[model samples]
Target: MRGGFARPVISLQHAPDLHSLRALLALLALVALSGCSLFREPPAPEPVEAPIAASEAEPAASEPEAASAPEAASEPAETPGAKPAPKKPRPPLIRRHKPAPPPPVAASAPPAPPPAPLVQTHTLERGTFRTLLDSEVRKPDGKVVGRAVDMVAGPGGKPQEVVVNLQGFMGVGDRKANFPWSAVHINTPAKTPAITLALTPAQLQTPERPKSGAPQPGSPEAGPTRLPMLDANVERANGAKVGRVVDVLLGGSADPLAVVLDVSGTLEKRRTIAADWSALHFVTKNNALEAQLEMSDQQIDASPAYANDLPVRAVSPAAPPATPAAPAAPAAPAVPAHGDQ
Candidate 1:
């Protein structure tokens, strides 16, 4: 009996120890459930991405094109049919011009007429000659019949007679007739020295000569009265001064042909002498005669009359020496005999 009691007791101790161990194990399981509530369980990790290669990186950069699409969509639209700008206007062109014409001419005037003749301005001096002769005689028909030959003055210095010679039968048997000075009229205007007669040619042919015893008054024999010679200076037509009258030249015994004048001055310086009757023109106012010839010193020296006998006499302050008479020639010596010893 005692041995059985000891064995039951040993069995009870062993059962209590086993119950304590089972309680400790239940507490450990409750702690594990609370940890699961505090920390969630990690999902299975997504498959890890791989790093891209350089060649494959282009696709990743192209992914930004989706962000640029919204900016392009925000741009404004363009309008249609807008006009082009107008061109600048051009400037206008100017026109050119031409010149004009001249004026017309006027009319001219007419002309005029001519003039007349003049008279000679010379006069004949008085008393230089006793008888005056007409150089020519003309008929009524203007024919020259004869020239005056000689003229004679009466006792009282009057022209008493005029002689004229007529040519008959070709100058043979010439007839000389005496006429009264009253019947002869001087024609100074004729080209030749001429005279006009109131009587016809027949009357001149039968002219009656003046009788010596007839009463001279109221008769054809009555002579021309004498006129005095001018005592004034005489100038030659060439303007030479003639001082005095030396002589007169006459065609016949009683007719006056030309005038001789003496120029006053020195003897070596010869005097002027002129013979042209046409050159004789009397200046009554100056008491001078005018000669028309232009005479030179050589011409005056060569003159026939002046060269031989100088008309001018030199007036010296003192008397000139008397010319001595030439001694008579000695009688020729007796001629010696040809056989003289």
Candidate 2:
């Protein structure tokens, strides 16, 4: 009986064993279910209702996490029968600036007229040319006609005529003829100095003899007016002979400006002086001609002296020497001023 009771007890223990095995089987199944849920991939997201372009798609949730994710590439869909949008006008590769207007072209001016030619003239003073005195009057063919004796002056000492002495055989038919100075040409600087006459010798001779003590007809001078210029007497107002007229200086008009005088005895110093033509008065005294000065003999001595080697200096207007004021009567000799005689 004790053995039988131990067997039943064993059986009871065995029954609890089946219960534990069942429990273990249920736990293994639960474990298997959990593992499947944990390893299973999630269901795919629902398909989107409308597709979006790559430009309009939302950005990835996390840049760092999704950086390696490949982006979906979608081509734009083209609708049939729809014209493609016109391509935008392309900007020019190189822009150009408006060219500046060309500079204004100046009109060419007319060339200036050629300038007029310049002419130069030189005027010489008198006394610079050789005196035509005693110069042989000749024709153009070198034939001597006569000798020029003197020149007769008109008013203002203008030498209007020249006296020609035609010497005949032994001075027998020697006659004088007065020709206008203009008709005579003097060339003293030539190799053979001569006075050229425009006319031949036949034109100068006359059949009629000139009256005594008279000038030839049509001569610048008549009667006693024909006097030689050189060695003519120059006297002072007091009738005292002062000097002789040695030269007659002519001007541009060939009129005598001044007469150079040889004032030899008129002053202590033997020199010359130029007297203005106006200072001289020509008169015929006793049928003789003389130039009289408006000054006295003493006044002529006070004039300036001149030299032929130097340029001429005209005589200045004579001014009287100032008389010294008489000394104040010697102060009455201080007649004995009281205390001291």
Candidate 3:
């Protein structure tokens, strides 16, 4: 075995331990530091001087107001290109209260016009009517033609026609005629007016009723004619009987002004108010016929105060019993005791 095995002789004396190597390396490093060292140390930067504060007397550059203020540690600095901060919102407004308005009023209507003052009416008796029946109707040439038996008035209350007892044997027969009121002259001043013929009596007769096939005078082919206002009874709206119209007063133009009302009753005074066209309205009730009045009895009583010859005598309390005249001074005793006879 000895012949084949050869062990290498190791140089243990020259090889270094770890601690010794460290010492050698440290020594070398010190040597390198003395010379130009492998990891060279940079020279310390030049001594930097602090910025100098400006003296009170020195003119200095202006700093912005925000930059001059002391920094707050809690707030962060703003960077370029950053979004802006949001604005505070405004408070809401308050409203005022107003009062409600009042209610509206209604408008009034205008009043109507009153009646005219120029008309009136009066009533008369049938006996007075008969007395004027036989009055003579003479012509303008002084020729006697007929006698008036009755009178007729239009609805307007003006005399329009008359019934005449024409010339016959001693005025005995019933021959009669109808004449327009304009064809006669009335002497109303004569206490009884004599109806004088201003035209021929024969010309004034009512048109004769024609044959069955003839043109009717009062038909639609002919014009309308006036109706009689005579004997039309008058009344109030409440069915109260007022009066009858006896005579009518005509104006200067021969237009009827008023009709004389015959208000014949126990306490009624015959009077006339202005009788306009409304006076022709009439009514009948319970066999009593009447012409309507536009007003009531109270209204009639309150018509304008009329003056006549009747004087208002103020009666006195009669003379206080005449005081008996002191018994005529006792007649002076006639001196009988003196025996002067």
Candidate 4:
């Protein structure tokens, strides 16, 4: 039989080695395991959308859907471009100072009785009362009577009566008039130092005991011979030197009224003060003239100051120089005028 179709036949260029067979098997295995997808490029994945914010994701109120659901309250939304505002810090707490309450008033003191009104009082001490003796004695009408001459002390060593000398013309014909101590008001004396006399000059002149320049047989003046203690150092009962005696002033009946003391203290300045004679005692130590004042230095300083250097001695003022008499006009200048020719 004749084959019309081409007989099935094969041809090889060369026999394959063992190494080449192994390589062909590995290549066939890789091709069978892998899918066709590996041959084509992988498809690009779809992009995932990010979650939107409540302010941006929601629709505005004007939308019909948004109007149906509970309307979202309208609030201003921060723009993406603007940053959020920083929070404000709280203010610090302030503490205030409180003032203390006023002090409580003392109840027991009756709210402190309105400060007692200041009061001033003066007392008539013995030393002050005696200074009146050296002063002048005058009538109630201020009529010039005379200067106090002496003071007569009673049993208590207190002045019971005083004597004044009536000053006549030119201090001449002066007479000592006896007056009752009770009749004189030493206080309320004038600045010139004058006493008020209860009796007139005539009544005082006609005093009992003596008449017409006569001395009684037995009188106090005749009893003891006492001399004045003038220019003497005066001390106090406390042994403090007060002053020195300047002069002695007399009252009626030849008794001492007061002694003018020129005080010399720490200052060494001299000022005269009249001390009561009744309070003074004649102290003769070593035969020197000195007096011991019973009063303190304060009392002596309070006495009236004497103006005259020698107050005890009375000197009449000299008559003023006779005024010159004017000479008569020059004989009328002689009417020697032309009419006289």
Rank ordering of all candidates by TM-score, starting from the highest:
2, 3, 4, 1
| TM-score per candidate, chains pooled | 0.26, 0.40, 0.35, 0.31
State each model's CA lDDT, in order. Answer: 0.44, 0.61, 0.48, 0.53
Superior candidate under lDDT, 1 versus 3? 3
Score candidate 4 by TM-score against the native: 0.31
Candidate maximizing TM-score: 2
TM-score result, candidate 1 = 0.26
Give Cα distance to truth, residue 17, candidate 3, Å: 99
Over 258-312, each residue of candidate 1 has an lDDT whose tens digit, in order, gives: 4444553665554534333333443323332222233334433443342223232
Model 3 TM-score (2 dp): 0.35
The true-versus-predicted C-alpha distance at residue 25 of model 4, in Å, is 60
- Model 4, stretches more than 4 Å misplaced? 1-134, 154-156, 187-193, 200-202, 206-260, 263-341
lDDT by residue for model 2 over 148-183, one digit each (tens)?
Answer: 766776443446787777767777886677777777
Report clashes for each candidate as comma-separated counts. Answer: 10, 0, 20, 6
The window of 10 residues in a row where model 2 has the poorest summed lDDT is: 1-10
- Clashes, model 1: 10
State which candidate, 2 or 3, has the greater lDDT: 2
- Relative to the unseen true structure, what is the Cα RMSD of model 2? 26.5
